[model samples]
Structures are given as structure tokens and as C-alpha cells.
Target: METRYDFVIVGSGVSGGYLAGLLVKSGAKCLLLEAGKSLNPKSFPLSPMDLHTQSSWGGGVEFSRQGNLSLYRAKCLGGGSVVSQALVDRVDNEILEDWAEITEVEAFKPSNFSNYYDTVEAVLRPYEIPRDAWNRNAEIYLKGFEREEYYWKPVKRAAHDCQDSAKSSDCIVCLGGCPRDSKYNSLTRSILPAIQAGLEVQSEVEVQTFQEKQDHVEISARDKNGALTHYQTHHLVLAAGSFGTTEILLRSGLKKYLPALGTNVSCHPQFVSFGMFEEIVDAHRMAFSAVTSNDSKLRRLGVKMDSIGIDPVFVSMLLPGARKSLLKNLAHYRNLASISVSLRDESNGNLSLDRSGRLQFDKPTAPKDRHRIQQGLNLSRNFLLAAGAKSLLPKTQIFGLYLAGGCSLGTDLKTSVVSPQFKLHGSQRVSVTDASLFPSAPGTYPSLTIMATTQLAYEHLRKPV
Candidate 1:
């Protein structure tokens, strides 16, 4: 690796990868440092119980009912994109308006985000799942929603050609990595292009701190060997997700300068409900939602529900039973259909470091949030009943896949960490371009929205700096 570069990105996730690709396209020298090891897609895990623990923190998940729910954030080179379902959704106009008002930035306006969405979509080539490829389990949802007269929309995913994989059970391996290379995660779509365009990437190099200088920013990191190395760059981008980015800033003592460094972290809480049917459903055929809800009742509760599929191993854990009951559920896994509920909670959490420098989360799910969750659960139960389900099981609470806030962006430095340009409020050479900059948790899937935000940040950073 070179001793100096124009830009040094701290995380190799969607934001970092996408921004690095754009910078390399503009002929800027970029270096991307990832905290996790590089992945060999060929060996990606195929079973839900297969814990690639080294590539993730607690299997890249956290289960907190009163705080962050079943939160899953991959710590690998490509970050969450490497493990996510790649569900792509644009930010709604109302959400953008809220962001614009909070950040006091015109770029958050609906029109501006539209242009970024177009560009990102063109690059990612997100497509909707075809009707024919719907598994027996997902098909039940389509018919059930239609029968209930609830508004539903097909899910758009970041993939090239998924019909073949969608037809088989291959799509079930989406959590670890795409076995057929059909999904468009940052590893395959963005970072690889950046690498080919001369962007240097250092894997398993965990950034500890950063210092801004007159001419360049100094970055300190530790490799897998525990040896510390320092690097310099004219610009520093933090795309290490909410938890990672916030932890780095706190560890660097920026929390003293930015009081809101690790405050107001939001993880949209979620739950799952299983609808047991008489006939075989075989949910493993497609272990993700092919459609999401647009029901008025759900909107009132700030909730979203979608079809869900799980493997036998995970189902065994979800099933309520001792050994015999667990075995019974496993045998009938194919006869179960599922729906997942995500709530846009008003309650927010805080991120802090324990005495040992380990990150600690305190997000108490407020009573209102719990009420909303219960409302969503009841509605889902009613829907399943109407769908001819013989039995229903409401799963435990977990954090949604999307997480935001922590290092929020706003006009007030007292309440936020970054500015409209994504630059640290009091720093010139440092900026955060990840979910850490979001003012709140989004109600929908956040991968596409994060990419769009990065695209906007790239445009602002590409100019002379």
C-alpha cells in the first residue's frame, strides 16, 4: 500500500465501497480499510445455523427486545451487504423531508434524492422478483394478501438474474453470500470495480483513531497481528455503519467535542409470525420476502410486514419446544409460512463504551413502541387466520436489519456529529458517509437509501477539497 492517498475510507461496506468506486472513477487515489477478513464467496455458508463467527460479531447479530432488536451487521470486507438479503427500497418523500429539515440541507429534498436514486439504480440494476419464481411459501403470502384486500408491492432486489436461483432453493443462501453470484452486494459490484480502478483495500485492519492535520489526516489502525500502523490521507471517510463508526469516534475522544457522537442510535425493532398450513409450504425454497405490505393499518402503527422464509435449523430455534416438540416442528418445517413485522419506533437508544472499551448499547423499547409492536402482531395474527392458517405462532422480538443514527447529521453540532456535507461538524478533513449520519431509523429497508446517501456525499466530496 502507498504511504499517502487522496482519500482513505475506514469501512468497506456499501457506503465505503460505493464511494470508493466513485472516487476511483474520478481518478482519485483511494484506500479502503476493513475491520473483518476478506470473504471467499465460493465457501459462503449455505445453512442458517452455519455461524461464520469470525466474519461477524456474535454471528453478526444482536437480540435486544427493549433495545436493538435482532440486529445483524456484518463485520466483513463488504460489510452488511455481504450478508444482507439485498432488499432495495427508495426513501419515501416524507422521510426525506424530515431528513432535510433536520440536516438543514437541500440535498435531502425529494427531487435531489430522486436523481441519486436513478444513478444508484442504474449502477445496481435492482429488479423485482418475477411471479413465476415465487416459492410455494411466498405464493401463499401473495394469495393471502390479495384475499385480505391488503395493499402489497413486489420487493425489488439488487441482483442481475435471480430467476433461475429463485426457482431453486439457492436463494436461501443469501445470508452469508450469494452462491449463484446473482445478488449485487458491494463485494462483487462496487469494491471489486474500485479495486480494478486502482483503489487499494486493506482487510482485517481495524481503525482505532484519526487525527486531522493541516495537510492530511492521520489514521491509526491495528492489523490482525496486533501491530499498529499509521497512514495519512488528504480526506478520511467513515462508513463503518452506526456501531462501528460511533465506537471509533468515541474511542478517539471526539465524543468530548461532539456531544452527540453516540447518542440516539435507532434500530427498527422487528418480530416474526408463523402461519401453519395444512399443505406443504417448504419455506426454504426462498428464504426471503418477495413482497411487503402497504396496508393502512400498518401505516398507522408505523409498521411493515413481509413474507419470510427460514431453514430447518433456524426454525428449530424459533419453535417452542423441548426435544420432542422441536423435532416435531423440524419435521413439519415445509408446512409453515411466515411474516415478519418491522416497526418504525419512536424510541431511540444510546451507544457507549464499557469500562473495558467494549461498546455497550442502551435502547429501551418504550411502552408506545411495545404497543405498536403488539398492534402489528395482532394484525398479523388476524391476517394469518384469514389466510386459512390452522395455527399461528408469534415469534420473539428482534432488531430489524436496518440500523441508523449514532453519528447523526444536523445543523447543530450540540445535537449531531456531521454536517450537511457529511463532514464532521468541527473538522475539515474528516467525514462520515454511513448510516451513522442518519438522523433517525428509517421505516423501510436501508441498503438502497444508504447507497443513495453515499452517492450524494461523493458528488460533494468530488469537488476540490
Candidate 2:
């Protein structure tokens, strides 16, 4: 006899974990399922290599079908929040307006959406990186921005009591996982509390598929021990990020009913450029990205630039050239500073399962997207040159962490997977509330928005339909 839950939420990432907390607080019996293992602050990987390999899907090294871009997504208990820098930023009003226009959901507009943003911010308690804590890498970026006369601002992060000095190197280790517990990830801020309030959690259980019966939703998954298990829930919530959720849906044969089950994919493709400086920048000693570009022109062009600090392993992979030249470039690792250009792509892609039931995506860099990337690169090169960089190493590859869309929200069933109510188009009890609901790219740091949208989805779920 399986105990049926009020809600069985799959993928305890940002959205699933947070939504489970809300449901349990409302006295709903919820079961949260995560494919990854639960890890505490002390158990988090300390080195970048270990962190990348242990904490993410495919050892943080999955590539696109075209092999032109690298894709990384967290597979840990708290998902990306555990591995990300936790940069908290809201979508721009213009971008929200565009979303509202696309989805025909007025709630997406700034006037209505701000409430959700306000609620999530109150919970996350994000703070801007103060100037006093800026490192030499940040100083160099700031100097470049000033010299280039481009508007810039400090990054806001969902962290508290971080080390004040840039020399601590504590921030570098945070890329793996924050040992100090200062970062407000879902495991600490939401999922743990939900568990305390009687929310059941099943980590290391990979959901294979689900079925929506007349009365209840049935879930089939494989436990960590490779045993098949089944669960029953009154309502099914899929928060398995973009790829995970889409893969599940495609595998379930829902694509036959929903024409857009795995379409309209958008990832903010990022290209990293390195600048060799005369002085030892030691960018990895401080925050990963303490400053972000705020140039209105760049924003209008759907481009963003930011100062970045990455571990030596990632630096070596991102740097151009090979063999002796690569080793020669690596010798100046201590003096290299990096900047990343992220483009809000206009082109959309699709996701499908290959013959072996493996996830496959066709996301090519469109000409428009390529133009934006080139523009960003040109500006970045100028900034580095102005900052006194002797030589530049352009990015050898493009990568993206902000994967979004597939089960997008809209009123039209012909083109969308999820309805405006957050329910799957053809399923009454199945819902999706994650980055999978993004109709298009928000052109900004998406973590804060993903959480805020989950808050909005909770409100919708609590109401009588």
C-alpha cells in the first residue's frame, strides 16, 4: 500500500525545494524527489576539480549536440544554488514586458511581478557586493569600465557574512560549495525547513516517468539501489530544471499530446576572454563576479559583460591555443584576468531524445546571437586593452549555465507546454514551475527570477481553480 501524498515534486532544485517548503507550510503532504545525493556544508567539495566533477550532471562537462557549447547543470540536493555564486537579479522591466507580450500573461509584467520578486528577495536576503570587498581583479574591471566610460554596478548575491577581505580565498571555495553556510541555498533556507515541517525527501531517486490518472498521478522512479519504485500523488510537480524536466516529459511520450513539449529552448550562452596583465591579478582570491556591466546600449543589444574569477582548471580549458603555446599561456596563470560576455539569444532551439533515449538538443548559435556575441567580445577586448592587458586569449568555447525553456507558459496549447496557470496543457494534475516555464530568455541572471516565479506559481496553486 503506497501512501499517496498531496504533492509529489520531482527535482529538488531551486524551484522544487522552495515549492515543497511552501506546500508543507500550508499543511500539504509533499514528497520531494532529487536524483542527486544530499550534501551538507561540511561535505561539499573543497577543490574546483572535485566540485565540478562531484556536484553536477555529467561531471559538469556535458556538451551540445553540435559540440560548439558546453552545458553545466548541478545535480546535487540544492541543485544550482549549491554550486552557483547565487547572484540574485530581477529581470529588467522591458524584458518582463516582452514576456507578457509573448505569453499573454499580464502577471509577468513588472507591475504585477514585482510582488513575487519582493517576496523572494525578502526570503533570500540578497546583498550587493560592497566596494570595500572588491579584489584586484574587480579593481581592474572597474578601471576598465571607467576608462571605457561604460556604466557598471556591483553584483548582488544571496549570501551573508562573507569574508570582507579579497585575500581570504574563501569565495573561491564557494564555487564548489560554501562551507561557512553563509550562502542561502534551498537546502538550508527551504528544503531543510520543509523536512522539519513533515515534508518527506527522497534523495538519489531518479524519476523515469509519470502517468496522470483520473484521480491521482503515478510516478515511477529508480532508487539509488537501482530498484524500481512507484509513488502516488494527488498532484505532480516537475521542477527538474530545463533539461531534466523536458527529458522526463519526452520519455513519457507526452510529446504526442503537447506539440511544444521540448521546443523553444534558450540558454544565455557565455564566452570567457582572458587578459594577461603585468601584475598578479589573483582573480580567484575573491568573489567570482563582483561587478556587472550596466551599459544601456549593451542591454539593448542583448549583451552583458562581467568580471569573472575562475579556478585554474577552468582557466586552462577556456584559454585558446594548444600544446606548448597552451602551457606557455598557463605559466602566466597568476597574472591572467578574465571577463565573460553573456548574450540574451534571440534564436530558439529544440530538445529531443536520441535513439538510445538520451537527451539531445539542437541549439546552434544564430547569426543574430553570433552578432551580439561578437559585439560583446569587441567591447570586452577594448576594456581589457584599456586595463593594461599585454595580450588577450579569446574564448575557445561557448558555455551556458542558465539553461531555460522547453515547457514554456502560454495560453496557446499549440505552441506551449504549460498553461498560464502553470499546469501542463493536456494534464489536469501535472504542473511545471521552474526554468522550464520560461517562454524566452530573460536576458539577466535568472536564479532570482526562477525563485520569484515559483513564488507566483505557489500563489496560483493555493487558489481555487
Candidate 3:
């Protein structure tokens, strides 16, 4: 006999972990499933190479079918929260307004989401890094912004007691995992608390498919050792991220009922530009990201620029030269300053499974999105030049860290997978509350907004229809 849980939440990332905590605190029996293994601070990867290979899906280097961009998604117990820098920024009001109009969900507006943001902030306690603690790489970014006369501001991160010092490069290791436990992640902030509240967790279980019955939902998954496992749930929450959630639904043949199951996917394509300076920048030391572009025009154009610290392995991939030239450029790693430009793409793509039941996607950078990237690149080049960079190494390889949409939220079943009420359209026992619910690109760092939106979805779930 299978013990049926009140809620079986898949993917113990930001959405799943937070939702599990809330549901369990409300006295609901919940089971949280994660595709990756649970790792503690001591077990976190020690090097960038190990981090990318172990903590991310496809070894952090899967490219699109069109070969236009590389896709990186976290596949660990805490999902992206474990590997990210913990930068938390809310979506702009303009983006939220567009979402409200597109989904016809008034709760997406700033006024409604403010309280949820407050709730998340109270828990995460995000704070801005002090200017004095800025690293040499950050100093270069500040110089460029000041020389270019572009608006910039300190970035807010969900970190505490980072113990960041002028000589400390501890922050760089955080890209793999924060060993000091200073960074707020799902494992520390949500999943562990939910466990204390009686939430059951199953890590290293790759969910394959689910079927919604009249009364309960049946789930089929495979454990790490290749044994099939079954689970029953009164309510199913698909928080397996955009790609994971869409793949599961497509594999389950649910697309016959929901045409938009894997449509309207948007990834904020990011391009990194490196500037070689005469002085040693050591950008990877101290805080990796300390400031972001606050230019109003750039925001209106759906472009964002931020200082970035890249490990040597990733920097080699981004460097333009090859062979001897690449090695020569890499030798000056300490003198390279980096900045990333991310565009809120207007063009949308879709996800589908191949003949072998493998997940594949076609996400081409649309002409408009290309234009935006180019515009951002032009500005970034100027910033680097104005900051006294001797040479610039701009790579054309595009990648996306922030993945959203696929199972969008709206009022109509013809175009949306999830209803505004957070329930899957045409399914009684299933719901979705993750980045999969994004109707379009939010044009911002979405970590803060993702958590806030999950809070809103939780409110709807707690109420009876």
C-alpha cells in the first residue's frame, strides 16, 4: 500500500522548497522530490570544474539544437540557489504590469506582490554589499560606469556574514557552493525548515511521469540506482523548473489536452565581454558581483549590464582566441575584468521531446533580441574602453542562466498551461508554481520575484475552490 501525501512537490528548488515549507507548516503531509543528490556545505564542490560537472544538468554545457546558445540548469538538491551568487532583485514594475495584462492576473502587479516580496525579504534578509568591500574587478566596473556616466548601483544579495575581505577570494568559491553557509539557499532557508516541519524529502529521484486520476495523482520515477519507484499524492505540484516541468508533462502525453504545455519559453540570453587591463584586477576575488547598471534607457530597452566574476575554466570558453593565443590570453586571467549583458528577449521558443523521448529545444535569438544584445555590447565596449582597458576580448558564444516560461499562466486554456489560480488547466489534482508559470521574460534577475510569486501561488492553493 502506498502512503498518499496531501502534496507531492517535485524539484526541491526555490519554488518547491518554499512551497513545501508553507504547506507543511499548515499541517499538510508533503513529499518533496529532487532529481539531484543532497549535499551539505562540507560536501560542496571545491573547484569550478567540479562544480559545473557535479551540480548542474548536462555537466553545465548543453547547447541548443540550433547551436545558437548554451543552456545551463542546476540539478542539485537546492537547484540554482545552491550554485548561484544569491543575487536577489525584483522585476521592474513595467515588467510586472505587462505580466498582469498578459495573464489577466492582477496579483502580478507591484501593489499585490509587494507584501510577498516583504515576506521573502524578511526570511532571506538580503542586503547590499558595501562599496568599500568591492573587489578590483568591481572597481573597474565602477570606473567604467563613472567614465561613461551611466547610472549604476550596488547589487543586493541574500548573503550574511560573508566575511568578505580585501584579500579573501572566498566569494568566488560560492559559485560552486558556499562552504561557510553564509549564503541563503533553499537547503538552508526552506528545505531544511520544511523537513523539521515534517516534510519528507526524496533526493536523487528523477521523476519520469505523472497521471492525474479522479482523486489522486500517480507518479513514476527512477532512483539513482535505476530502480523504479511509485508515489501517490492528493495534490501534485510541478515545480521542476521550466525545462524539467515541461519535459515531464510532454512525456506524460498531457500535451494532447494542453497545447501550450511546452510553448512560450524565454531565456534571458547572456553575453560576457572581457577587458584586459594593465593592472591586475583579480575580479574573481572578493565579491564576484557588486554593482549593476541602473540606466533607465537600458532598462526600457530590455537590457541589463552587470560586473561578473568568471572562473578560469569558464573564462577559457569565453575567450575569443584559440590554441596558443587562447593560452596566452588565459595567462593574464588576473588582469581581465568581466561584464555580462543580459537581454529580456521578445522572441519566444518552444520545448519538445525527440524520438528517443529525450528533451530537446529550439530557442533562437530573435532579430529583435539580437538587436538588443548588440546595443548592449556596443555600450559595454565603450565602458571597457573608457575604463583604460588595453584590449577587449568579446566572445560571441551566448548562454542563458535564467530560464523561464514553458508552462505559462493565463486565463485561457487555449494559450496557457496553468490557470491564474495556479492550477493546471484541465487537471484537478495538479498545480504549477515555478518559473514555468512565467508568461514572458521578466527582464530582471528573477530569483526574488520567483520566490514572491510562489508565495502568491501558495495563498491560492490554501483556499478551497
lDDT per residue for candidate 1 within 328-429, as digits (tens), equals 666777788888888887888888888998887887778999889888888777777787889876465465567788999998988899988789998889
As for candidate 2, its clashing pairs are none
Error of 1 at 110 (Å): 0.9
Worst 10 residues of 2 by lDDT: 162-171
lDDT (Cα, tens digit) per residue for candidate 3, span 257-333: 99888899988999888889999998888888999999998888888999988888888766667889888888898
**Which ranges of candidate 3 are over 4 A from the true structure?**
none
Worst 10 residues of 3 by lDDT: 163-172
The residue pairs that clash in candidate 3, if any, are none
lDDT of 2 at 272: 84
- lDDT string for model 2 (4-114, tens) is 998999988889988998989988888999998898888999888888888889977888898878888999898888888888899899889988988888889999999
Q: How many collisions per candidate?
A: 5, 0, 0
TM-scores for every predicted model: 0.95, 0.98, 0.98
Q: Candidate 1: what lDDT?
A: 0.81
After aligning candidate 3 to the native by TM-score, how far in Å is the CA of 138 from where it should be? 1.3
Candidate 3 has a TM-score of: 0.98
Q: lDDT for each of the candidates?
A: 0.81, 0.88, 0.87
Q: What TM-score does candidate 2 reach?
A: 0.98
